[model samples]
Target: REQADLQRVFPDLYMNSLSNVLTQGMNRKKKHEVEALAAVVSWIARSVGANTVVDVGAGQGYLAQVLSFEYQLSVIAIDACSHHGRITNARAERIKKHYAAKMHKSRSEDRNLNMPKTVTCRVLSTDTFKTLSDSLLQKDDLQKANLTGKGVGEHSLEGLPDGNVPSCCVDSKPSLLLAGLHACGDLSVTMLRTFLECKDVKAVVSIGCCYNLLSEEVENADSQCGFPMSKGIKSAGLSLGKSSRDLACQSAERWRCLGKDAGLHNFELHAFRAAFQMVLFRYYPEILITSPAIGRQGKALRRQHHQRILESTLHHEESAHSSPSLSQKNCKKKGSCPTMNSAEAGTAKNKGTFEIPLSDTGNSTPKSCGAADFASSILEMDALFRGVSFNQSTKCEATKSVDKYSLFEKFSRSGLCRLGLHHLQDINFAGLWKETEPFAELIGPYWSLRAALGPVLETILLLDRLLFLQEQGNSLEAVMIPIFDPTLSPRNVALIAKKI
Candidate 1:
């Protein structure tokens, strides 16, 4: 993917759409996207002279409801998830009641609002999608639609020529214009293919997301892949490696807008995750290869980590009183033992380090004693293991500062135990984190750069799709437009095509 394509695409290729999301049960960000996309779908429907709008991957049917009730376009909302269809229908009923109440408030003579028909179907292929699209337009579906005033199948689409009528559609005229908001991977490409293949589907408005799920032709040519759709790309034999494809979905703009402290906090999380991976690699190599996913231990354990750190720091007195043998009173007051008071305990707590002064006595605390020294009162293992130095601290400046390695180790055990690896023995998590901790600081800058590079990958993909549509013929008018604020919706660009 060329970086220049980004400049080329942004300045000229995408049409900017503006609107507010008014649908219920949606967050502010989702509302912005839905409203903008619904507006575009309405415009395309009017331009293409299509009476019906088929919203594929309708999710909970936010866009579908808007296009139907707000824009007054006949709609058929389809999703692979059966539960989504049920939710959409339920929500649609609520919306319909709201509309009815509004008309009553105005005291206007109003007819019933037509609800978008819900269809739960996994659209796998062009033929499969075509069958679903065609069947819903037949006389049987039309009779069903008559129950509501001029619903999806019963829409008047008289002007479409014989070429636009499918073999299955005898007398029914469902001039459908397809619309998809964040259609995942192959489903988006499948809609485009279906639009070209099915006669009744005269136009398409699609916005795709989840680039990571896209299959590559290079991986297996037999599989109907989504990437490199254009002859331009296929001719070049280009492939977006799976890792880079995953990067394409990262929203640099969203990350860039994050507050300074928030951004650094997120970066620290990435560090913890990286070190945890190192733990798996060192201790459970076979399990790491077998079940690669540890499932976001950094995120799940963060609250617990912070609580433990706070408690260990603030509750030093509680731990200090527990073991009388390791108590400061047990040591020669003027000996190598460091004194602890409210101030010293507070300092140690904030520093998140457990420190014990090294002694000249042959029975001196080992260099590693500092690793978990705050808990020396609790463990009291020093008396039992005389020669075996259980708490050896590595002599490193970075390790001397704040012992995040211990915090990371704490996180690692929780993660490992979550995966039922508690029975494994002799796993040195502190040592594992120490080896990789130096690279942790680089994560913030590296992530920023990766986020910046994401849009380039996304641009190349959209360009390939646009070029593919153009490669079809001049009879098709196609475009990739910015339909939502990128800050609100990272996958904001929509791929739209209409028969000219």
Candidate 2:
């Protein structure tokens, strides 16, 4: 479809406004990115001849509204974030009213029974996948909604038919499954795997985000099983390796080069900020402070606010540094700090010679480690953070061998963890999950960050698995489509299988 056609179909007026806002500062040519995305969505819809489309991360339900209203296709928009989901639901209600009014005015009768039912928008977090699915499978409201072209009222999926699968529209299992725009960490992966596991889901179109959150495990079911394999075949399914960050780094490098070419010193800063903004929005919900009068804040005030944040963080670091324990002294004595040397101390005669006494209550002097091993661990962490490229085999080994307690010990002693903050152990993952739980509840949804990350990592690792599926004499009825947009970093790569 053409740009005008796509615009006519899009339901979210706010998203249209956002497109305009995003384009305001960009160059004329670059301003077409949103338009291009809309066009791509329209093209995919037409290509699949989809009668019903469900967007997994349907923020604001812009695309869902448009598809339902414009193409006359039933749409189900789902999101883990309750705030966004509520906004989308409200927008859909507004559009439904508008459409009903327009039909009455134009004297056009609502003719078709299957002509797009009221868009079913739900606030569903990705974290509670199994729970949500199980609840959905038992819900009667959804079953009635599916059979009749009516919407499910305020109800859980407790009595819905086939609610075991996330998508309610897949009863007869439509020929097409669509997830247009999705977000970081795990959401994107969940969509791809959902498509893979659900038999009625014939085609999938998805875009993914958040590479680092993906699981390192290779044997996940979602990643291994693309099509319906026999019980024996399923068990024998091969494992896909770890998700690679090479593509993400490549994108970063390109941005860096672009910045250098333009003589911009802080190109990487801007790039990093843009990348971090997505993470902060998804993981740290508090960072999004939406004030109605925020636009009125002056440049000076904004700068002051930024400075205050930086200063506050620095102050916290300083406070943490002032208190030193016995372990810290031993860490220092081990010569972990490259700058501290015997020769430098000798030259600076007035320098204080601080020593910890060998006592219990006053803190006993801790034993020191061999200088070599301490230095080696430090170097290893440094190397990991340096973004050095490593092959999948080597990378997996390195990650598995890394000791969490030692890293925590190092962090506790030197406070370097507070400074660099690069190493991400299993405990860090656990803590992140714990932290995200309350936020998920605040948003009125249950989305497991780990489950989402696992599937996406599975999808990336299973790029080869798709190739294997094709190689194993599975007919070319389904084509693997890796959705990669140069403008936006590749979030997801989906395999679309069509029944020829």
Candidate 3:
């Protein structure tokens, strides 16, 4: 899809109308989304004659604020996270002041901003939407104009107070338009279901992320699964296991954009993480069942790795300044001396092929790794063995025996310490690296090819959503449009539908 698709479809009423004040706190990527989406949805609300636009999963109220203040349309900002609701309210106040100043409106005149009503409630099922419809419609809205700031509410759907009314308080029946930006997993699917079930909900414009987190019926028959929302897939028994769903979120463009050094570093990190599963399997077998995910230990390892280099550099500079170092003098005479480069040192190993022995043959032979299978297995292993608490570590002999695994030893020890594995006194990380290191060079090429398949999964999932809307009967119109730059926002397509 072209980046200009959004701009082309809606020419006269579009992104350019946004100001710096409106776009504050948004980065380039977010700014692009808000500007493009706000314009299109604004035009949609107008075209469809929707009085109130309800933004489901409205984090920080960026889109809601734009619709309420700029477009002068009433809006409801609903989010499950209470903190997001709190933040959205705070952000709304700031934008109100900006708009007031821009338009030269008095406190009494500020009612024209039509500040979005903040609702902090979970949209778990269609039942929530039914309750929301009742709560909003049942309120007395004649005094909404007079209430203004007083009417801006953080009300729950269970009940509304006489003193508190909604900012989008309607005198007549409401035309509810549902929306979500990066609504997580089941929440996005929940919105589509709501749109279909609730008569009051006339339209829905949704963009979702976190496919990995989406509930699957195959995983658990009890919980409602977000996948296979379309009847066609449900009948076909198509289930993308969480491992593959996580892979669906990968970006081909992001990988392509990486420079050689950065890319290779990432590949090494992946190999180390895969090897981490071996550590878990050997020392803490039971922990795999528990699936204890200590947050971002890989990222922690990366941070620690960089910190060591920085500290070493500082110590070397200080030593050079304090005294006439022979190494420094020799380095000046013979150009800059290089630090140990693992890739260069392992040139011989990289060329060697790795293989898993076949059970019947009882012979070892070189085997080419299938990129998809390798990525899937590695991802599943990481997911299974994650959050390992290897709190205790034995002194690694591998780092001293062979310099290749010095960094790997650090990574493994850090991982072991996190998993609290103390009894592994003779864990030979070098042997494990020796066993698996031959496959390290193959990771970059294999993973790159695997990453390309991400969109195929994404497309099928999106198609399922589209088919769901279509199968609901011809009374509703549905379309999935490529609205934003896919490179900037990988989940760029918006699922939009309007009931006839």
Candidate 4:
């Protein structure tokens, strides 16, 4: 059908090039998946004899482009990505060229039988729905406001007549709709809801990914889902299931167990080491030298690196205290003597008098350290020591925690405390759990509930599709095939309406 349509709609020049290039530069693996799904959908479409198809979340338009060109079906491809839409549009244009060439070739053999080759392919952004809807309503309001000599204000359209609304000329009912290869979060949900609301959308096929970004609860009351949606369910009200939640919980527990098994003494250090290792593996795959083979061989190098880092940090600390600044000298001249080292400075306040060694000035008087100067010097020393300690500790713990679980725990606990989980008191399980509860409350159950509901909401939307078709006087025979996927876990569940 697509080939026939292409022959009629495209010019000779473009069609020839499109057909020639169609087979070129195609990835066999990806094309096979497309072909497999397309074959199933196309067969069903043909059996149903549906002429129009809308592909929702149609990334790059590969599936829609193929269907439009090959089946001569009118295709509307919608996606959120502008670049993806453009790519699809470009592909459609090429398909048009390919069809035109076929028509030209066939013209010589058959003058009487002309193919009606008008295949309309529209690449649309998801926002196009809102924009189009708004423009339609606005146009009617402007016309009414014009008669009253009151120019339409942005807010003025609130009172427009329903009849004056602009209608999208595209069929209110389409034969088939597809959301092929939809991405993370709400995109899949949006497509499913679109299927439910659009009465003309007869059939839908969708593949969804990125389960993590979905919202657990509907913050926006005016949202399409209507009910309070959790993170798992799509905006359309599809819930994934309890099993998904169980799996997620298990995965998290496994991660925690892994951390514990590493024998990290500090919970803070263990957590940091685990996270750092994951990130390092992801971003710096080459730097991962901790495999059994390398770990055994690189022991000397690792030790040397560790020593060098320690030496550098100690040098930095020494340099910080070696020279007294001009302010310190001025304080000294004002009879505010410097404290002798940190230990002496710490003990001087309790003693009530701080003794300071003065340069030999041939005078019999000994300089005494003022309380204020002693306190200030102690604070400065403490700040310097803490800063150096934290930096060095974090780096060391991140690198070596895997080998020494005790060190990992210390670092992880300290890190967690900074993040506001203070319960990691002694790196034990009890302390870890106590510290983790608040943090868990902030991000855990809420997100888990949201993720688990995704498949459920999908199921609901799919049922809604079936119900919509039934209301339209179409039996299950005509509409059910496209929406069914055996591979989906929650199979055999159908939408059944009861008298209650």
Per-model TM-score, in order, reads 0.70, 0.43, 0.72, 0.38
> Per-residue CA lDDT of candidate 2, range 58-121, in tens?
6555656555655455655655444655566566566666667667888875642112222233
Number of clashing pairs per prediction, in order: 6, 20, 13, 52
Q: Which stretches of candidate 1 lie over 4 Å from their true place?
A: 1-22, 139-167, 219-223, 295-403, 417-425
In order, what lDDT does every prediction score? 0.65, 0.39, 0.66, 0.38
Q: Scored by Cα lDDT, where does model 4 land?
A: 0.38
Q: For model 1, how does the per-residue alpha-carbon lDDT over 383-476 read when each residue is reduced to its tens digit?
A: 1111111122311122123345544544455455556565245666657776887898899899888888899999988898889889999889
The better candidate by TM-score, 2 or 3, is 3
Residue 219 alpha-carbon offset, candidate 1, angstroms: 7.3
Model 3, 59-155: lDDT tens digits are 8899998888777878888887778878888888988888778677544553566788887777778776656655565343423323223234676
> Evaluated with TM-score, which candidate comes out highest?
3
**Model 1, 12: alpha-carbon shift in Å?**
20
TM-score of 3: 0.72
Query: In candidate 4, what are the lDDT values of residues 241-347, reduced to their tens digit?
Result: 43442332222222333322122222333243444344335434564554311112123432333344456546544654685464345334422212123343222
Query: lDDT: which candidate is best?
Result: 3
